[model samples]
Target chain A: MLLKTTLIRLLTTAVTLFGVAVVVFVLVRVAPGNPIAMMLPPGATEADIAALEALYGFDKSLPEQFVIWLGGVLQGDFGTSITLRRPVDELVLSRLPATLELSIMALVIAVALGTAIAVIGARRRGTATEVGLDLSSGAVLSVPDFLWGLVFVLLFGVLWPVLSISGRIDPQIEVDFTSNFYTFEGLLRGRLDVVQSTLSHMLMPALALALPLAAMIAQLLKQNLKEVLLQDYTTLARVRGFSETSVILREALRNALLPTLTLVGVQFTFLIGGTVIVERIFSYEGLGNMAIDAVINRDLPLIQGIVLLFAALFIVINLLVDLSYTLLNPRLRHG
Target chain B: MTGSQTHPNTLDVMQLNIALPNGHRLLRDVSLSLRPGEVRVLVGESGAGKSMIGKAVLGILPQNLKVTEGEILLEGQHLNAMTPWTRRKTVAQSAALIPQDPLTALNPARRIGPQITDPLVRIHGWSRTKARETALALLDRVHIRDPKRVMESYPHELSGGMRQRVLIAAAFAPSPRLIVADEPTTALDVTVQKQILRLIRELQQETATAVLFVTHDMGVVAKVSQQVTVLFAGKVMEDAPTERIFTDPRHPYTRALIAATPSYADLDRPFSPVPQALIAELQDDIVRDDARHQGGAR
Candidate 1:
């Protein structure tokens, strides 16, 4: 049975990724602007456009072009970008690490900050502290994430200048692209300055993305933890002389957090969605910025590659969250 | 030590008055006492304040309810007068509770071994190995044939009777002087309930730990308890030795409760519910008492 379910998940992921690729390819072809117009300078002749089209094989019929593109994708070649003049795979690969770093950092912030507030509110339920946290989290949850991105940029970039808001690193420093992830590459090469610079640049964008997600997580945790606190096991913990901390953290939190995992999984989808505008606002060179540039220039190959990759990332994250259900609940695990 | 002939009253509850947040007095001047190895059953229908007595003793009462006037003395220690932390410490060392809903009473995420032996490790400062051994011994005492497998299994992996037995073992881990078993078998099947009750009674007799078994089932009270208290609308309608209460119940409420109880021997006998007139009178007294308390506060 387990093997059957495992095979089903793998099959579904592959099918869905193929569907996303087809959708992206169709949308790009149907859109108004041709890639050749955007490829050449403004006053270039029609001959120049035709030559470029022939070079990229876009002059072929749409079906033939699709088959050629599909063949390249099947063979692990994402093709070259019409706008950037580099391999689509290389461009996405360079930006993939940055996007992952930003999302991971934001998610860490969200879970940590949200859990601390949730614990405080749950412990002192009905008190002013709980009420205040609830009100504040509700307010933050209501605001759009892009506005948070703007607010954070103004506060950190203009007012305090506490950290750098944009780009992966200071341009002046000669940096090696060992892993494309500056922090990982820096640590690998024993360069503290590079790691520091990469992290400082990451802090704002990650925070901008995390604040709304954190507020969302806190609200769910508070509500669910309140109910779990009243469960018989919680009372049993107290009756057995376990400390209040032990009761809440070990017993109550596991039961309470079970319900909130669904909300956390949903919030992750929103976090991935919010990355486009957030990366643009902070001038961070992640997949979000790459996607926008591809769209503007009608770079079909680059757009197709990035969208498929995003779909794959999204599916993988959902799979992870689903697997985590077994960990958080023993009944599900044993079954 | 289990058979030591100490004074009869191991736990003393005197003049306990608990009120709701709305100033609705629930338990008015309630009191009871227990002797070592004795079982006192608090019997009442739902919402009759039967479990409230158990909650007050454990200090695990709901936040909305407060014990305004009461003293719960365990082995001459004043549980009511102590600070919350101190009361918790004193209670943990000398008392325990076996809760309702056997399925939910044990944490599902935990193995049966750590959960049963946690008090020994945390409160008694026993080593992990010692706790495991004690836990295994406890499983044997509870008639769980395969001690090693039961120890490693989660609560959901066991039957209802098995889970209740695990909880019963945990309750007696510290050899508590008093155990508040608040309808510990209410959620189980009839046969499982009988087995759980028998196990609890056998363990209580063996360890000489007093048990305040809360239940509405007379069959259960008859099987497990030495004495019984019949509560009706927050009042103790009858208190007597178990057999005597069964044979010569004096209160009208007690008579109604027994008549209302369904018996297997007599299927044609009509099960009569408590009369509305009596319930009205009890509710009226509560309203009057609530007004009086409000007036006194003013």
Candidate 2:
């Protein structure tokens, strides 16, 4: 049954990805703007434009272009970006590490801090600390990440300036690197300063992404945990001599994590969508910005490629989450 | 099974009283004691505080219910007077509870092996290998046919009876002096209930662990108990030998309960709830008792 469920989930993911590919391929074309016009020199003649169109294969039928692009994609080619004059795959890959690092760091902060706050809230249900944290989380959730980004920029960036609010690192400092991922490259090169610089730059954007996520995670887990604590198993744990800490962290958290896992998966996908704004605010060069640039300049190939990548990542994450249910619930593994 | 005895006064609840933070009494002047290898069954209706007694004995009352005026003694040590952390650590090692619902008693995420070994591994610092072996042995002792398979399977994978058996084994894993079985068979069928009761009895007798069995079922009491403590609205209505309580019950409430319980000879008998005025009187008694001991528990 587990195997059958997994197979069904995989098939659903494939169908959804295919649907997204078709929708994105059509949607970008229907939207008004022209990458061809933008790429031409200011005084270029109509004949020059048509030559450039023919060269780029845009002069073919829309179906022909899609089929050609689809073929290349199947062969691991994402076509060239008209505006950037680079392969869409190369552009996405170069920015992929930064976006992944930011998203993961944000998730880690959200889960860790959110869980800690939630545990405190659960333990002190009606206390002032619980009420205070709850109110703060509510306030944070209401504010958009870009707004938070701006606030963080002024407070941590412009005002106090303890942490950089934008970019992957200080553009002034140069370093020889092995990987596109700054922290990994710094660690590999034994450069502590570079690692620190990377972290400092990531702090504000990560915080802007994390605070609202943490609030949501806290809200999700806190309610479930409070209910779980009243369960017979928690009482059993107490009777069995498990420490107060152990009961809350291991037993209570394990049961409370299921619903929160779904939220985390959804939040990750949302954060990728959020990257356009987050990257723009922080001036961090990631696929999110590349996506916006593609859409505004009507870089059809780049937009199609990025959207497909995003859709595929979302599908894969969902699959992993579906697999995680068996881990969280033993009953599911048997069924 | 130690096949040897330890303390005569394994557990002693002296004029125990439990109340909410708002000062409403939950248990009033309730007291019961257990000697090593003896089973003392707490008999009461739904709200008679029978389960509360088990929790009190284990020193694990819910936060709302305070032990305002009682000292629970374990082999003569005053558990109520000790610091909470100290009391908890001490009670955790010395006592174990077999809660009412087998389905809810075990953590759903963990397998039987780690869960059963929890007490020994966490409390005794046993290595995982040793703990798993000990857990498997305990499962075998509980008559689990495929102990290896049972150990590997999670709580949800096992039947209710199987889960109860795993819980029974876990409760005995630490070799506790007191085993608080709080309606351990309430969720089982008649046959499974009997088997679990018998298993608990056999294990308690073998280990000589003082058993505080809390249940409303008189049949359960008849099957396992040596002494019975009958409660009414949190007050002790009667405390006597099991045979005496069943054959010649003194309290009007006890008499009514026994009358309510249908026997083979009395197949058409309907349950008679205790008189309301008598319950009101019991409630008044608790209020007066609380007023008299206003500042602190006696």
Best by DockQ: 1
- Give the winner by TM-score: 1
Q: How well does candidate 1 match the true structure in TM-score terms?
A: 0.94
Model 1 Cα lDDT, one tens digit per residue, B1-298:
1223356367888878888876577887778888777899999989889999998888899999998887888876788789888888888888999988888888888888888887788877889888888788888999988999998898889988888888888888878899999999899998788889889989999999899999989888889999898987777778899999889999878887887889999999877788988778767876786678678768
Candidate 2, B222: how far from true, in Å? Answer: 1.5
RMSD versus native structure for model 2: 3.5
What are the per-residue Cα lDDT tens digits for candidate 2 across A218-329?
A: 8889899888999999988887777667888878988899988999888878876787788889988777877888888888888888889889878877778777976887
Query: Candidate 2 lDDT, tens digit per residue, B1-298?
Result: 1123453488889888888998788888888888878899999899999999888877678877888777788767788778878777888878998989999988888877888876787787889888888788888999999999988888878889999999999998888899999999999988798899999999999999999999998888899999999998788989999999988999878887876676877777765666787768777876776688775643
> How well does model 1 score by local distance difference test?
0.86
Off by over 4 Å in 2: A1-10, A41-44, A170-178, A188-193, B1-8, B125-134, B265-298
lDDT tens digits by residue: candidate 1, A1-335:
89999999999998998888888888899989988887688999989988898999989988898889989999999999887889999899889998988888889899888988999898888899999999999998888877988888799889988888788778877786667888887888889998888888888888888888899888889888888888898898887777777788988888888878888887887897788988998888999998998898899899999998899899988888888988888889744
Collision count for each candidate, in order: 0, 0
Question: How close is every model to the real structure, measured as TM-score?
Answer: 0.94, 0.91
TM-score: model 2 vs. ground truth: 0.91
